[model samples]
Target: MTTPESALPMVVPATDLPARVRIHEVGARDGLQNEKTAVPTSVKAEFVHRLADAGLTTIEATSFVHPKWVPQLADAEDLFPQLADLRGIALPVLVPNQRGLDRALALGARRVAVFASATESFAKANLNRSLDESLAVFDPVVRQAKDADVHVRGYVSMCFGDPWEGAVPFHQVVRVCKALRDMGCDELSLGDTIGVATPGHVLELLSLLNEEGVPTNVIGVHFHDTYGQALANTYAALEHGVTTVDASAGGLGGCPYAKSATGNLATEDLVWMLQGLGIETGVDLGKLTATSVWMAEQLGRPSPSRTVRALSHQE
Candidate 1:
């Protein structure tokens, strides 16, 4: 079989990197939540199925937030049940409060995430609550989910830099991260919401989190590509022994509050690098590119991912 020049890269394994990495795919949820015009419910379902078919194991299905807040996901009630047919895939949904949690639990969702912010400014802007107040809101949500034996992911956004409060100090982020760990979060994702983080800054935060008692195994990195440093920052995280990564397929979404912020690190771009480095992510580059291209058609825009554009014939 001939490998398409666009499809394959030579594998060259390196030392000091994790043998395998788990990509926390957020395309179906994070990628689509900000669309000005919501994609159809059936198309959203098909996108998730295609992502799973392309070997992404962990897919964030959707958010259960109220329609008034994020009208894009108003179909959560109708959509969650459609995904039950998928087997052996971990479908996690974002729950903003007790009401969001209740709706998710009622739909039989076993994995859920509560998004928090490392800076007070972002918490106030994104959740319309103070940093501590937002955590307070999630405390019972996490506790109740734990009581039900459900897995919880705590997302600490604006971990590196904040638009309102620029260059957030490491100590501020540490406090928020520690709070989530103490609240029984099974895993934590540190987010560079403004896409301003450098490789050194990323390594420093991961090292500090380790010293502060947050193990690398339970921590994932979510980087934005605004400054074009996302891949560099991610490489630094991998060198520090962090394996799980959060990426948006085709590089779809950005911080709505931060106008300068770009999309999340593209999954196609990440997979191409992992494949070249011989890191096993279990993501099929060919099929994943095709999925992104198909999704791009749904949005009537070309994908922003360099790798997707390079590898996809449809694009």
Candidate 2:
């Protein structure tokens, strides 16, 4: 490959002090959403506690969406009350609409996430609304969350490619991200929901955001391992100043759009990378690995993490 000097940045002094990045552990929600057998709420709570114990400051406990949409997390209401007494863990739950938000607020949720799709088709399939309409639906939710002093996180799915609409434009992504930020979302996770993103694409998208003056600190990346490039893309995002990355422990998530993806970037794999780069994730890799292994056993499957595989027989 002929290297274009302009395509890649010139080598600069590497920062020995690793950038402080927050890893929002999504293994409990995204990881369990697609499974046929619903994981018990006790198991879910245990996983959340384990993740919290591993020094993950933020953990997505579950989704408050309708059980019809995601049967696996139907116990969100049941789970929340049990976890309500626990303190020191920032448990953010996914709320798909006002009803979901209401359910969460009733359980005293302090932080909630509303997800929107960048592509119209995905929005329609996922939320039964057009992109614009979906964005509108979340406006009031964001307002209410803000008024109640609850942090709101917005997710823009399919930032890379869509099953119905291929090759999402960078402009569309920027527009969606801007809209979410404007709606008072404290943070926005630019999701490669169906994956299909490359390092170059990630850098290009971040450059656009930087150009638009969107605060990079409030931006996060959620990548699926569709083409086996999620970690590489994540490193590219790190280099471009993205400090928050979403990963599932044990690589336990797959896209609803099955043909386009498998599991997400494994948390263990991501932590290993961050550790290697001298970044402070605050997550204990050994604990994460052990928890992931236990979770995989409960789910009756092998962990998708390569690091887990290499370390398994050693124990």
Candidate 3:
């Protein structure tokens, strides 16, 4: 009768932390998209539903990129409508272009995201366009989504480091962020795509963004665990008054376009930290870990989340 919360961290309240944090759950879309093989559309739908049941309010459901570009999430058309009954939870889908946006909007997707990069190399590699060109591409997509009364989230990748071009400049990251904000994105999610961010670097970039007119309320942080700094960076963000975080359940996925990127910060692990800090996340840690455990079983592999393994007692 062991429960996941049996080993929970002692909640020591942090005066600087936000009263509540919104976790933008990405396991269903960003996580599963990296899978070598696509799970069935039914499985994908269930994963999203299970995540909601676990108290994840913002679940990234799927991507609307063309099948040729992302075969795993090609089921965006078949999968989104299945979650029609999931009221009260936000289901965001990645819409890579105007066409992708069309597909998402047609299926009644109210929340959509567009991916951009801060480095030219990552832009060329991931989007096959220069940084400026990539921004131009998203211009119409973001415009149209906003026009349709849809919520648009702009994801700025490689904010900290780029494998092709090491250690990005703070101003360069801020420029792309400004462009997204100017282009009418409702909010921005800064990505530590390569997981090379430290707390100082995270804090500095955040300060620059704030200086450049991006309000703390409209900014979210997405970090990878490659260097094991995701949690520390997240704490830096929380200390900066940022409340939105991007994490995946069971630490299931990485950036499919960036080979150097690793799994995202695990929701359970982040929840553990937030819970320990006595910061409210509204996530049921036990139910969330159990859901990840169930998903790991379906994937035929152990979850990479340390918290999940510890709670489930897996080696």
Task: List all candidate RMSDs to the true structure.
Answer: 1.5, 6.6, 1.1
**Candidate 2 deviant stretches above 4 angstroms:** 1-18, 257-259
lDDT of 1 by residue, 1-315 (tens): 123765688888978899999999999998898899988999999999999999999999999998988888999999999999999999999999999999999999999999999888888888999999999999999999999999999999999998888999999888988998888999999999989999999999989988999899999999999999999999999999999999999999887667778899999999989989999999888888889999999999999999888776444
RMSD of 3: 1.1
lDDT of each: 0.92, 0.85, 0.93
Least accurate stretch of 10 residues (summed lDDT) in model 2? 1-10
What's the distance in Å from true for residue 169, model 3? 0.9
Each prediction's TM-score versus the true structure: 0.97, 0.93, 0.98
lDDT of 3 by residue, 104-218 (tens): 9999999999999999999998889999999999999999999999999999999999998999999899999999999999999999998999999999999989888999999
Q: Model 2, range 39-120, lDDT digits (tens) per residue? A: 9999998888888877788889899989988999999988987776568888899999989999999889999999888898
Top candidate by lDDT: 3
Report clashes for each candidate as comma-separated counts.
0, 0, 0
TM-score of 2: 0.93
lDDT agreement of model 3 with the native: 0.93
Models ranked on TM-score:
3, 1, 2
